[model samples]
Target: MMRYSWLLSTVAAALLGSPATADEFGDPEAGAKVYSQCKGCHQVGAGATHRIGPHLNGLFGRPAAGLEDFKYSKSFQRAGASGLEWHAETLDAFLENPRSYASGTRMSYRGLKDETDRKNVIAYLRTFSDDPANIPEADPTATPTDHDIDPVILAIQGDPEYGEYLSSECTTCHQASGGDDGIPSIVYWPEDEFVVAMHAYKNKQRKHPVMQMIAGRLNEEEIAALAAYFKNLDN
Candidate 1:
């Protein structure tokens, strides 16, 4: 009995001192305010419906391109089909550059430059979770793959319905008609070339602070989705 008590006490202590759960990461309050930047297209909170972008409720631990009903870019679908799951690091990287993170994603907001800002945003997202404080720890064994597929090719591989959904954000600034000064008109960019440009922005090899800021947040697949959406634009 004494040995069992000691074992229980040791387990409790270890658990208490153990690192954060997989579901835990960073501050929702700060994330809430920062997320305001995303409100133009995305909707969160209770009973949130899909908007210009799809709903982000319970985004944590969900599939990369998992929103239902709302159309998603082909790139997003491919990523989701590839079995990518949302977590702290994934969200952090994505928040930094949506296009670079996914190759063809159509989200237009530049990523949060500061790491703390990303963490805060994660925190805000956590609030939507049933257990906001404890996020699951990342898989230590996971490593990024070296998929060298062309962005445009991947975009062509994406879904047009999803592309249309993502296009809503782009149309805000990248109108098919003459775009704003400095903002490139995305009416007819080749998918492969667009993917390359977005990657350059992500790596900081490409100039343009705005583009860099936005690109830094994306993944290869997102870049593909955004590229696909623009490639199919009527204008």
Candidate 2:
């Protein structure tokens, strides 16, 4: 089972029966100090342009990956599509562990293991917005949940003939033959591998923008057909 170190204090406090008034509202001043830790990849305040990550200005209540200026990973966009709006809860869960919250995200930060730090940083970031209260409300104690996939869902077995029909779209970037360049060849791969790769793209666990878009358009049956075609092709 995955551990939630960030929630330990909150849980312990609850066990001790802390008063409701003792909510974990961090101080902006202290959060400003904590924000320094994030300065390497993010920026805020006036004229903040995107760095490794998007600027934090007006972040509260914004949809995930909604920034037009910053180039976000497709995985991040997928999280937004899955009803992930930025609120204190979402940010806390994310700051706890970006990769865990949004699987396969490119943000390499290890994570703020201390829950208070995450709260403080979020408090500081809230300052960037004009009216923080105007943003959406969320449960402060909420966290992201991991889901298990049932392999049986991909029930449609591979079909090579139909796979060839779908090759036109894939062949544009991937080599039809088993040679490779900047884009790798899809031909002659194991059917299972092909299916998993395609699903990864579809679910935005992989970062390629184009692949994510294409995968989103495909269904499990269509994907199985393509996988079958590629897996059966001569090397």
Model 1 lDDT, residue 103, Cα? 54
Off by over 4 Å in 1: 1-25, 135-235
For 1-235, candidate 2 gives per-residue lDDT tens digits of 0123325644665689974343356566778898898889888999998999888988876878989877887667776665457766667767765655565478898778777777777777877876634222322322332222247745668677777888888888877776566555567766655676677668764446787899999988899999788777775
How displaced is residue 182 in candidate 2, in Å? 19
Q: Count the backbone clashes (under 3 Å) in each candidate.
A: 52, 0
For candidate 1, the C-alpha RMSD (Å) to the true structure equals 14.7
Most accurate candidate by lDDT: 2
Q: Cα lDDT for residue 109, model 2?
A: 85
Name the lDDT of candidate 1: 0.63
- Candidate 2 versus truth, CA RMSD in Å, comes to 10.0
Against the true structure, what is each candidate's TM-score?
Answer: 0.50, 0.51
Give the top-scoring candidate (TM-score).
Answer: 2
